[model samples]
Target chain A: MTAAQGFRHGLRTAIVSVFALVLVGTYVSVGALAHDFGFSASWVAAQTVLIWAAPAQVIMITAMGAGASPLEVAIAVGLSAVRLMPMVVALLPILRTPRTRGWQLVITAHFTAASMWIEALRLAPDVPREARIGFANGLGVAFMSVAVASAVGGYFLAFSLPTALVAALLFLTPSSFLIGAIRNSRRMVDWLALAFGLALAPVLALGAVRLDLLWTGLVGGTAAYLVQRLRGGR
Target chain B: MSVLGDLWPYVVLVLVGFLPNEIWRWLGVVAAHRAGEQSEFLTWARAVATAVLAGVVAKIIFFAPGALASVPLAVRLAATVVAVIAYLLIRRSIFAGVLCGSIALVLGGLVLAP
Candidate 1:
């Protein structure tokens, strides 16, 4: 497949996927919350473009609302984003081939979020090596468009939307992500990581607010890795 | 200038929100070039990422930040449990899971509204 064809395929898949609808619902919630917190619509839309990750965006906006300093906001957002490093690490290598340019890898990394990453990882194998970059980029562009538009629209709709409906919308991302994690689980380590992370988060939240996720990921992931090693499983 | 002051929030967002987040992706791109995809280090990284995301999911559900916090924690937890069970028993359909979960949340909020 050529780059264009791969791009088209990915674009079509993301546009039609059930996950895209969930993204729309989630970002609408994000936009509404940002509006409630007195952020301009452009601010939320820009966040959708730049941060792209829902969890990090939520953290930054809420922290800002709570009057956290800029430095504090950066630290919290950065901590939430540490997960992206590993996702990009796992994904870029799959998309890269002999002809893949350094610039392409750099550009693609910006578009790597959970939605695009999952789709790309699942779909890259079927794409020709040379076209994988286009495919992933297409997914990134489609999701970004959907997310940003929904956010801006939600900002406008925030006034009329009921609190109950907004609450329901906020539930979309976490439920969808949890289900996605369960679907992606293929091994004991994966299951253990999910279990450990879910159990550790509430406990860690009782202590420090800023570093809970960082600790959860580190401790839970390490525990899973060690358990897998002890079981002699790859 | 007054214009610069007006633009300060966007400026802060770019510096604080965009840069901090994008730096990790850049780091990953640099690292992926050196490490094979299936290497043990990459495996560990994947586990770490997955765990972190799972933590985010739990955070949003259990200790929700915004409007979700308005709904009682028990309702939120029950909705999530219902969603997971529905997803597993219903052909692993993500749509079904999210839909059921969302319906439960809305209904729970209504029933438990004070």
Candidate 2:
């Protein structure tokens, strides 16, 4: 298929799947939380567009609400986004071709969030080499459009929404991330990493370390990798 | 000066939020170009990323920073447990799992609210 056809196919897949509604749920939560934190609707929308990672956006809102300086917030948000590096690394090989321009990959890289990475890793291999980039770009754009709209809607709706509902909305982000990570687990190391990360986070936080999340992942992930190695597994 | 003041938040959002996140993605593209797909490094990177994300998820669930913190800890744990169980039982239906978790949270908040 041509680039346009690939794009159309991606748009159809995103809309027809649970992706659009799930994003609506997640981004609406983000919008409402941004409102609660005194951020303007446009700020949240811009965040959804630029960051395009709900967890990092949520971390930014929470940090700013807690009066963290921009530098501090950047550290936290940056740590949260480290996952995107590896995700993009994994995804680019699927989408890249010999003729694929660096600029196109750069654009596609910007759209490489958890969900897009997941979808691309699963679907890009089936796409023609020339069309994979288009397909991934299409997926990213569709998700971004939905997310921005819902974030604005949620910001406006926060005033009328009940606290209980707001709490429920806020839970969606973490729940989805956890489930997605679990769903994508294929090896012993992957499962062990999730388990170890979960087990380590609260423990590390108790020490009040400046970068507890970073330590949790490093220690837990390294431990998991070692365990897999000792088990004679790849 | 006033315009700059008004724009500082956006600047912060881009600098602190967008740039921090976007830089890694760019690095990944370059790294992928150099290293190709499968490698020992890629596997370790994936594991590290997954762990870090899982750590973030654990932080959010256990020590939630915003609206979610209002719900009791038990409620949050229960909701998360329910989500995982539902996801596994429902053939890995993500929507069903999240929906069930949300329902449990709302219900727990309502029923347990004083």
Candidate 3:
């Protein structure tokens, strides 16, 4: 198959795989937010589209509902999203080509969240560089669509669905990430990072609720990196 | 109500929230241009990223807010183990792993419910 065809195929597979999982989590969470906050479905949908990150969206919605000021919500959400930096750094080189336009990269950057990043990182190696952006865009557009729909659906269904089902749906996004981490486990450093992150998260949470992720990430990751370095590098 | 008065706060929130996230991504693009994957900065950054993602997942599973808080710790851990096992058996298929984990959690909740 040609490079373009390979990219197209990969894109379709990613869209299907991500769509099946992403919606349930975002839908349920946004629905819960709407029910709790008395937010309109339209408002929730707009947030989903604009924020485009599930964890941050959840933080923003929940904090705002709890009567946090907009500035506070923004800071918390933005800090939560600091993880996206490494994702974008790792992904851009693979998708970019000398011939690739600046606007294309900007657009791709906007779409680079966890699910999309995972799929792109997995798929880009095989796809021709010229086609990588296209592949990412396909996954991004599909992901965004499902995200918006799920937010709206959850908003309505939050009132009607069984709590158990909604709870199950809430687990979907994290489950997907955990699975992705497992699938991408190639180096000892990766495993160390995961272990440290898991071990440190709860401890960090005791002190800092909103910034726990950032702290855990920095400390745990640096520890893992140092360990790998001390071991003569992986 | 004036549109600006009502919407400006949300607009500000969007900008404030977006800038922090986007700044990192934009910086990443620039760094990627200058540095190879083998660079120390990239390596450390990648490690940090994985840790952050892991931390988030751990938080969701163990210390989740709202409805998920009701799930027992044993069930959550069991579901994760089952999911990991499924991922390995399936040659690391993410879909299979997630499917097994979600099913395990739901089933655990059902069987273990009081």
Ranking by TM-score: 1, 3, 2
Model 2's chain A TM-score stands at 0.84
i-RMSD of all predictions: 1.6, 2.2, 2.0
Model 2 / residue A6 / CA error / Å: 2.6
- Give Cα distance to truth, residue A223, candidate 3, Å: 2.1
* lDDT per residue as tens, model 2, A53-163: 988898999999999998999988887787787777767877878888899989999988866766676678889988889999999999899899999998988568777
C-alpha lDDT (0 to 100) for residue B21 of candidate 1: 93
Q: How many clashes does each candidate structure show, in the order listed? A: 0, 0, 1
Q: Report model 3's chain A TM-score.
A: 0.88
Could you tell me every candidate's TM-score relative to the true structure?
A: 0.92, 0.88, 0.90
- Which pairs clash inside model 3? A31-A154
Candidate 2, pairs of clashing residues: none
User: With candidate 1 superimposed using the best TM-score fit, by how many Å does residue B61's alpha carbon deviate from the native?
Assistant: 1.6
CA lDDT of each prediction against the hidden true structure: 0.87, 0.84, 0.75
User: Of the pair 1 and 2, which is ahead by lDDT?
Assistant: 1
- Runs in model 3 deviating more than 4 A are A1-7, A207-210, B5-13
Instruction: Show the lowest summed lDDT stretch of 10 residues, model 3 chain A.
Output: A1-10
Which lDDT tens digits does candidate 2 get at residues B1-114?
A: 999999998999889999998888988888888756567667776777778878878888889866788888999999999998999999889889998999998999788775
